[model samples]
Structures are given as C-alpha cells and as structure tokens.
Target: MPRRKKTFLCGHQGYGQICHRCDQTRTQREKADHARAEKKQKKQEWEAAFAQDPIDLRDLPDHVVVKARSIIAGLMTNTNYRDFGGKRLRHNRFIISIPVTRNYRMLCRDCGSFLVPEEVLSHEEYNVCKPGG
Candidate 1:
C-alpha cells in the first residue's frame, strides 16, 4: 500500500483517494468556510467594542456643534427676524411672529390731544388733563 497524492479545495482536510476529479461537494465546503470566517471576524470586532460601557457624550467624536460666543454674536445682529410690529417669540424650534402692533390711535378724552402708540407701550399709567380744568 502507498500514500496517494491529494489536493484540497476546501478546509484543511483532503479528499479521499477517489476524489481526484472535481465535484460540487468541494465547492460547497469551500464557500461555507469562507462565509464562516467572515461571520467570525465580524463577531469578534463587534464583541470587542460592545463589551465596554458606551462612551458618554463628552467622549463623543470631537465636534463643536456651535461655539457659544459665536452663536450669541450671530443672534445679536439677527434683528431682521423681527416682525414689522417689532415683536418676536420663538417656540418649538420655530420663530413665532406675532404682530407687535397695529393701526391704533388714542385721543385724550380730557385734553383732546392725540397720543402715539409708542408712548402707550411705556406709560404704565396715564392721567390726561382736561382743557377746561
């Protein structure tokens, strides 16, 4: 008896003596081995990272979403956002533009003089004197 020459298409194992010709069995095994190795490598990398506690936000990728002073500076000059009425309220990540003023005229019931709206927003209290008194 003599040891025979053998070629392996898959795994480390060699086919038996009668396996000299090619067959589907060899191809299937080789494909399976390749898929298994890929799966194992992915699993090892995943486990190595996932085993530790996740990083906090402070340890996240260094990205400055916004420099605070720069943002404040931008906001300071962004007055065009104000409505024609001179009022602005932001809510829900949206600018809520409510009319700060509308056409309004006021007459002194006592003095018969007209008063502007700007004076009204600041007065807090008013006592218009009558002409006769």
Candidate 2:
C-alpha cells in the first residue's frame, strides 16, 4: 500500500497538541475526578444522616461493649447491617419492652379477678379492663 500522509496537530507533542494518547488520558482523569467527587458526596450525606455517639467501653457492660465493637467492625468493613427506618437492625442494640404480667397469674385491678396474661402479646395490653360486675 502506498504511504498516505499523516498529520500532527503539533510538531513533537508539545503544548496545544491534540493527540490520541492525550485525549484518552484526559478522559480517564475526568472519570477518576468524577468518581472521587461522588464518593465524597456520599460520605457527607451518610454523616448527616447518622450522628455517632461516643460511649466509653469501660463504662458499658462487658457484653454490651463487645456487641458494640462487633457492630463498629461491621460498619468499618461495610457489611452485616441493614436499615429499618433507622429504628431496628439485625442486632438488638436497643431494648424492646414487651408488656406482660410479672407472673402467669395476676389480679386484674379493674375487676379484682385473677387473670392470666394473654399468650399473644400486643399493644392492646394497654387497654386491659374488665366490667366490675
């Protein structure tokens, strides 16, 4: 094949040169900068959503401290945590009080009758009442 003439925007790749390699490098640099910016933005949003409370491990119960440490480790490694409207997690970090009589049999204050706490627990326990006949 006969040699076709090629052209260069600059004589020896100096300033103002629009070479293929330079264009690719510029594109890669732009992509990298964009990704870094996105990561930074995500970090800021996450920080805003959750404020970390610093608790002295020494002041906490040994088991509580151990569980907290494990959760921290999971967060640091980006695993083992799920968001439940920011209320609950896979682990019970907060206490959930279930309404129940102190014993299986208890006096119903309303009717003064001995009653067994319901087997199924629910918020309805708050309205527990009996007709004082």
Candidate 3:
C-alpha cells in the first residue's frame, strides 16, 4: 500500500491530512509576527530608557547615546574628565566638552563639586554654539 496525495480545504495537494504547504506558510507568518513583536518591544524599552537619563539623549545616534551614558556614569563616579579627554571650552570655562564620537560631543556643566551633563550635540552644532562660529 502507498500513501495517496489528497487536496486539502486550502486547495493544496499533499499526503498529510492537513495542507502542509498552507501549514508551513502559516508557521512562517507566525514566526515573522513574533519577531516583529519582539523588535517593537525592544524599541519601546529603548525609548523608555531615555526618560531616566540626566540629559536628553533621544536625538543622538545609538552609539553616541551609549557612549554619552558611559561618560555620564564615569563623571558621576568621580572620574577625572581628563581621563576621557574632556576639556573646558575656551570661551565658557564652566562648560566642559567630552568627545562622544568623531562627530558628536557631550557637554557638561561645572556644578562646583560634580559635572552635570547638559546635552549631546553633533560636531556642527557644537561649533555653531561657540563664539564667532
């Protein structure tokens, strides 16, 4: 005796009781949906994390945000700004600029005892904010 192919309700012919083609397609769709849902949830969590940051980092690139956060954490823990290659702005001694990346900088304010992160700005934005820039 040999198995015979039969048409399922989905119009797909297969040897199984159910349409394997449709079932395979449905499983693939479910997997895709699950993946999309997970991605959405991760994005939501990432967005929510910004609220806890001392400075607004929502607009910075992902890598810049992560670097800025690490710098902020280091500053909070009494790390020397010099260690991170940070320098006080020539025009504004109270403002410190720390390089977050080649194109981004993190500015912090001198608050007597500790540095308070102000904002993360692109290289162009930082230059525009400088005197005569």
List per-candidate RMSD values in Å: 21.7, 17.6, 2.3
Per-residue C-alpha lDDT of model 2 across residues 89-125, encoded as one tens digit per residue: 1233231122222211111121122121112222343
Best lDDT among the predictions, by candidate number: 3
Candidate 1: which pairs clash?
Answer: none
Query: Which stretches of model 3 miss by more than 4 angstroms?
Result: 131-133
> How displaced is residue 44 in candidate 1, in Å?
0.3
Off by over 4 Å in 2: 1-17, 51-133
lDDT of each: 0.32, 0.38, 0.89
Write candidate 1's Cα lDDT for 6-99 as tens digits: 6665433344744534556678888999999999998686456433322111221222111212222333455332322323222222222222
- lDDT by residue (1-133, candidate 3, tens digit) is 8989898887889887788899899999999999999999999999999999999999888999999999999999999888999999887898888899999988888889999888888999978877212
Q: Pick the candidate with the highest TM-score.
A: 3
Candidates ranked by lDDT: 3, 2, 1
Clashing pairs in 3: none
TM-score of 2: 0.32
Candidate 3 scores a C-alpha RMSD against the true structure in Å of 2.3
Give candidate 1's TM-score.
Answer: 0.24
